[model samples]
Target: MPRIAEARDAAAPSSTEQHARVGRILEAAAELAAENELERVQMNEVAKSAGVAVATLYRYFPSKTHLFVAVMLDQIDRMREKFARRTRPESSARDAVHDTLLQVVRALLRRPLLSAAMIQSNSMAKAAAVPDTARVDRNFRQLLYDAAGIERVTERDAALLRLLVHSVFGIIQSCLNGRITVPDAESDLRELCDLLLAEWPDSFTPAG
Candidate 1:
């Protein structure tokens, strides 16, 4: 089969029952990954834990990487919902940027192990995995824009925002993997957001 066809097949949507089964499998995977490293979690164990057969698990997630990627997709969906429910203050864009990025920092830090697994899979994501990663990345970038309190972004601002996002991810991953302390990463994210969003509109009143 062609690469495009294969990619589509790999990322194809599941039926309702299939979706529930996949969710259960991912939950099981999350539980295992939270307690053990990626390599230490076995497919058989996940199936047993999810109360599904190994063959069924395989149909849902052919490999551990795919399983983790699906979990990451779920994570991003949650992050999307968060932004949707978040009430933006009548504050300056700069403040919005600061508060929003800080939200990302706090959320990811709360589940270090689970986030670590997702990050690991992302770092190793291949062509077949691009669709899953792409959706996650798109949702992430959208969240940043929503946080900026800007419905329309100029060409230059969009480019700059993308760059800022990449930098923030690097810093957070470093902290998640223990290459740097959380405080350092948080400080860097704050500074980075401030620098990039310096042009954020300042005309605003505090929301009462």
Candidate 2:
């Protein structure tokens, strides 16, 4: 029993250390991306900043695109969790949707460099073509399920929800690019949400 316990404790530290190392790499990559132009960011720089060898960085992340994609996905997941927690059972669907969109837009704005890198990556465009789109749809569907119960959702409603999510992303991108003002972007999102609610109020039950 003593030997078994010792082995378990030793294994636990190895697992924890691996997690800490990966976290350090990710944090270093984020800081570098934020501080420098995305076009100029290189794997060598990331490895150096991460205090890991280039081979180690490659072992963890196959390519720079993969690394950036992981970063964006992590950011999205964090925002999704935040929205899930902030949305309340007693909150009106429209209000919940509005709040969620605002939160996501604010997060993107906060990480402008990362957002820009994502937008600029041709690899991202290719990734978005299929698997990424499906993953995004799944995430949004889950959000919708949280806002409006799953039983109430239909195929048509799901399609509309996907459209709204894409539109919200477009609006945020436009705002970031200066193609639209912040107030205008907010107005557009509010109008879009209102239209969605009007068309499918039945899908979104008013919280009691």
Q: Which one wins on TM-score?
A: 1
TM-scores of the candidates are 0.83, 0.75
Shift of residue 33 alpha carbon in model 1, Å: 1.2
**Clash tally, candidates in order:** 0, 0
How big is the RMSD of model 1? 4.5
User: Which prediction has the highest lDDT against the true structure?
Assistant: 1
Candidate 2 residue 57 Cα shift, in angstroms, is 2.1
lDDT of each: 0.74, 0.64
Off by over 4 Å in 1: 1-14, 203-208
lDDT of 1: 0.74
Question: Which window of ten consecutive residues has the lowest lDDT sum in model 2?
Answer: 1-10
At residue 88, candidate 1 shows an lDDT of 76
lDDT digits (tens) for residues 116-163 of candidate 2? 765444234344322343454576557656765545567887787878
